[model samples]
Target: MQAILEEYLPNVMEIPDEFIEATQETIYMTVYTSLIAGVLGLFFGILLVVTRPGGILEQRVFFNILDQIVNIVRSIPFIILLALLVTVTRFIVGTSIGATAALVPLIVGVVPFYARQVEVALLEVDPGVVEAAEAMGTSPIGIIFRVYLLEGLPGIIRVSALSIINVISLTAMAGAVGAGGLGNLAVTRGYNRFQTDVTWVALIIILIVVFISQAISNWLIKKVSH
Candidate 1:
C-alpha cells in the first residue's frame, strides 16, 4: 500500500500529515457548518412557509421582509460573501482565519440556500393535508410540526443531503481564505507547487466525501419516503 501510494502520489507521501490535517479540517467544517446551518435554515424555511400569502399564519409584511432577506443573502457570491463577512466573522470567532472562523461565513453563505431548499421542500407538502389539520382545529404550530415537517421529511432529507454536498464544496472554497482544508491542500501544497499528483489525490478525496454524503442522503430519503 505504501509503495503504491508513493508511486502514484510522491508529493502527498512527503506530506501525509498535511493531507491528514486538511482532511480533518474539511470534515470539521462540513459537519459543524451543516448542523448549525441546517437548524437555522429549517427555522427560516418554516417561517417563509407560514408567513406567505394565504398561509396559516400569514403576515404579508413579515413574509416579504424575510423573503427579501433570504433572497438578498443568497444572491451574494460565496467568495464575495466571505469578504463581506470578514468583520462579522472576526467578532464572532475572535479571528478570521482557520476552520472555526470559516464556520461563520459558511453558515451565512449556505443558510439562505438551504433555507430556500427547505422552503421548496415544505411547499411540497399537500395543501389538503394542511387544510385538514386546520379543519380539525389544530394550531398553526401543530400543523407546522406534524403536517408540514412530517409530510416533508423525505424531501427535506433530499435537500439536506444536497446542502451537505454544497457545504463540502464551500469548505473547499473557504480554503482560499486560510480555512486550511482540502482546498488549501490542493491549492497551496498541490496546485501552487505544481504537484499534479497531490491535486489529483485531493480531488479524489473530496469526491469520496461527496459520494458518501449523497449515499447517506439517499438511504435516509428512502427510509422516510412513503
Candidate 2:
C-alpha cells in the first residue's frame, strides 16, 4: 500500500509529516467552525424566524436589523472576508495565519449563511402548526423548541450538510491564505512547486472529506425523515 501510494504521489510521500499536519489542520478548521457556527447560526436563524412580523415573538425592528446584518455579512465573499478580518483574527488568535486564526473568518462567513438556511428551514414549518401551538397556550420557548426545531429538523439537516461541505471548501480557501491545511499544502507545496502529484493528492483528500460528510448527512436525513 505504501509503495503504491508513494509511486503515485511522490511529493506527498516525501513530506509525510506535512501532509498529515495539513490534513489535521483542515479537519480541525472544518469541525471547529462547523460546531461553533452551527450553534450561532441556529440562534440567529431562530431569532430571525421568531422576531419577524407575525411571529410568536414578533419584533420587526430587531428582525430587520438582524436580517440586514446577516445579509451584509453573507454578501462578502469568503476570501475577501478572510482578508477583511485579518486584524480581527489577529486580535483573537494573536496571529492572522494558521488554522486557529482562520476560525474567525470561517465562523463569521458561515454563521449568516447557515442562519439563512436555518431561517428557511424554520419558515417551512406549517404556520397552522404554529397557530395551533399558540392556541394551546404553548410558551414561545415551547413552541420554538417543539414546533420550529422539531418540525424543521430534516430541513436543518439538509442545510447543515450543505453548510458543512461549504466549510470544507472554505478551509481549503483559508489554507490558500496561510491558514495551513490541505489548501496550503496544495498551493504552497504542490501547485506553486509544480508538483502535480501532490496537488492531485491534496484534492483527492479534500474530496474524500466532502464525500464522508455528505454520506453522514444523507444517513442522518434519511433516519430523521423516516
Candidate 3:
C-alpha cells in the first residue's frame, strides 16, 4: 500500500495556491456584494412600492424616474455594464483588475436586479394586512417595516438566494477580466495552460460553494418561516 501510494502521489494533480486564493476572493466578493446590494435593493424596492400610483406615498414623478432608472440599468448586460463602470471602479478601488475592483461592478450590477426581485416580493404581501395596519393608525414607515417587510420575509429570503447565485456567476465573468477568482484561475491556468485538471478542480470548487450557499439559504428560509 505504501509503495502504491508513493507511485500515485507523483501522478496526482497538485492544486495551485493562486487557485485557492482566487476561490477565497470569489467568496469574499459574493458576500460583501450581496450584503450591500441587499440593503440598497430593499430600500429602492420599498420606494418603488410606496411611490406607485395609489400607493401610500403616491408620487408620479418620483415613481416614473425611479422606475425608468431601474429598467434602464437592468437592461444593460452585466459584461457590458462591467466595462462601462471601469472608470467608476478605478476611482473607487484604485484599480480595475482584482477582487476589490471586481466588487464595485458586482454590487452595481446586482443592485437593480435585486431591487426588482425585492419589489416583487414586497408586492406579494396581502393588501388586506396593509389596510389593517393603516386602520390601526400605523404610520407609513411602521407599516413598511412591520407589515410589508415582516410578511414578505419568506419571499425576500428566496429572492436573496437567487440574487446570491446570480452574483456568483457574475464573479466568474469578472474573473475573466483579471478579477482574481476561480474564473480567472480557470481561464489563465486551466484553459491557457491546457491544464484540464485545474479547470475541473476550479469547476468543482465553484459548484461546492454554490451548493453550500443554497443549503444555507434554504435553511434560513425554513427557520424564518417557522
lDDT scores for all predictions?
Answer: 0.94, 0.96, 0.89
Q: Model 1, residue 162: what's the lDDT?
A: 89
Steric overlap count per candidate: 0, 0, 0
TM-score of 2: 0.97
lDDT of 3 by residue, 120-182 (tens): 999999999988999999999999999989999999999999999999999988998898899
Off by over 4 Å in 1: none
Error of 2 at 59 (Å): 0.8
Write the residue-wise lDDT of candidate 2 on 83-132 in tens digits. Answer: 89999999989999889999999999999999999999999999999999
> Which regions of candidate 3 fall more than 4 Å away from where they truly are?
1-12
Ranking by lDDT: 2, 1, 3
Q: What clash count does candidate 2 reach?
A: 0
Model 3 poorest 10 in a row by lDDT: 5-14
Lowest-sum lDDT 10-residue window in model 1: 217-226
TM-score-better candidate, 1 vs 3 = 1
Using lDDT as the measure, name the better of candidate 1 and candidate 3: 1
**Model 1's TM-score against the true structure:** 0.98
List pairs with backbone clashes in candidate 3: none
For each candidate, what TM-score against the reference? 0.98, 0.97, 0.93
